[model samples]
Target: MLTLHPNSNQDVVDQSLPVNFQDFIKSEFHDMKQDLTSISKDITSLRQELQDIRIAMGFINDEHNKINEKIAKMESKFKAFDALVTTVEHLRTVNEKLEADCNAKDQWARRSNIEICGIPEKKGENLLRITEEIAKKAGFDLKMTEIDFVTRVSSTNKVNKPKPIVVRLQSRYRKDDFLACLRKLKVICQDLGFAKNESRIYFNDHLTKFNKMLLQRAKVLAKERTYKYVWVRNCTIMVRQNDTSPVIHIANVDDLKKIK
Candidate 1:
């Protein structure tokens, strides 16, 4: 057994303790450095992602502005189109009124004329002689010079029938008087030396092509509604339900609705 001093034992313990503490401090410092490096790398990645998000937001904002501009342009075009449509409709109404006025003037020009229907046509027949014969049968004192002209006109109907005689008198008053006499006499084809044909002759105011069509429509509608009178006066279509009923002037196809 060896004897040892207390001071020497204390000095040895102090030297070993210093070496252990130093090693522990070095290990903790190295671990701290590694943690700081990892935190720095993570911060750098987060910054890059934030920058990318900002760039994407800028692109989206630009697209939104472009869409707004396109919508504004479309709205303007639609407004312009609506205005154009209104203008066209107004023009159409004006054009229709002008055409109606022109037609009225044309019809008024033929006021002094008379249309004779149900008269049999013959080759080389004298129209003036036939007209004079009609006046004689009706007991009307009509002179040959009172007639300005007489001619056969083509029928507007599709059926193959005798052409009607159109007579333009020198005076409208004379034409009216002659028509009234013929109506009162109720002259027929047989009275005019057509012994085989007995169809009653018809005397009417000479109407334009348009007025003739309108008159036909008025006659059909009046008959359907049990109207007693449908006739043309001075090229104007007239309709009456009865003797006491108010007369209706039919100016166009739309007037047909007035019957009911």
Candidate 2:
């Protein structure tokens, strides 16, 4: 119902609506599409992170299982080691006990005072018996006696008492026979520190040296008035290896004997 000019009517119509409405709608759509795309990307990232977390968890679980298995094995090995240690301790204790028992037995044997022969008759009978036993063990038998005499002085201070005769047994038999006896006696006497040169005296030269040394010591010891000089004589002779031989005096104490 309105009459208007054509240009003014167009201008009025344009002014009635918003400007660039289609472009605004297109821009809004573009922004919304971009937002949706970003959201999708975020969701994909979140999913990948979750997957990584799950994989990591699986790996951690596998590692934990392996660790547990290793711990179990270690515990088993420790127990085995402990058992082995216990066994070794037990063995050591047993060995120590056995050794102690053996030592006790050996000590008892060494300390036992069991006599090998009958009671002795003379003052030096025990010494003779001991010597005899030692000799027998070493495959020899010889008589041993003390030499020299003791002379007591009289109360008057004028004359000394007559010294009693003292005799010492010298090996009267052949050097081989006496040498064997001497060697055996030396071995038995070695432990007691009675003499040191017994083992080294083998030949005639060694025996002569040993005898000279012995005589020197003996002379020094005979300074007592009661004892002047030691007289040694070989009393009896019997083959040690053959017990069936008759016992006889082979020589005197000073190696002077008839080898009949």
lDDT of each: 0.83, 0.42
Q: List the residue pairs that clash in candidate 2.
A: 149-226, 150-226, 151-226, 168-231, 168-232, 232-253, 233-253, 234-252, 234-253, 251-257
Name the weakest run of 10 consecutive residues (lDDT summed) in model 1.
9-18
After superposing candidate 2 on the true structure, give the runs of residues whose Cα lies further than 4 Å from its correct spot: 1-17, 20-25, 112-260
**What lDDT does model 2 reach?**
0.42
What lDDT score goes with residue 196 in model 1?
85
Per-candidate TM-score against the hidden true structure: 0.69, 0.38
- Expressed as tens digits, the lDDT of each residue in 103-154 for candidate 1 is 7887777777888998888889999999999889889999998999999888
What digit string (tens of lDDT, one per residue) describes model 2 on residues 39-94?
99999999999999999999999999999999999999999999999999999989
CA deviation > 4 Å runs, candidate 1: 1-77
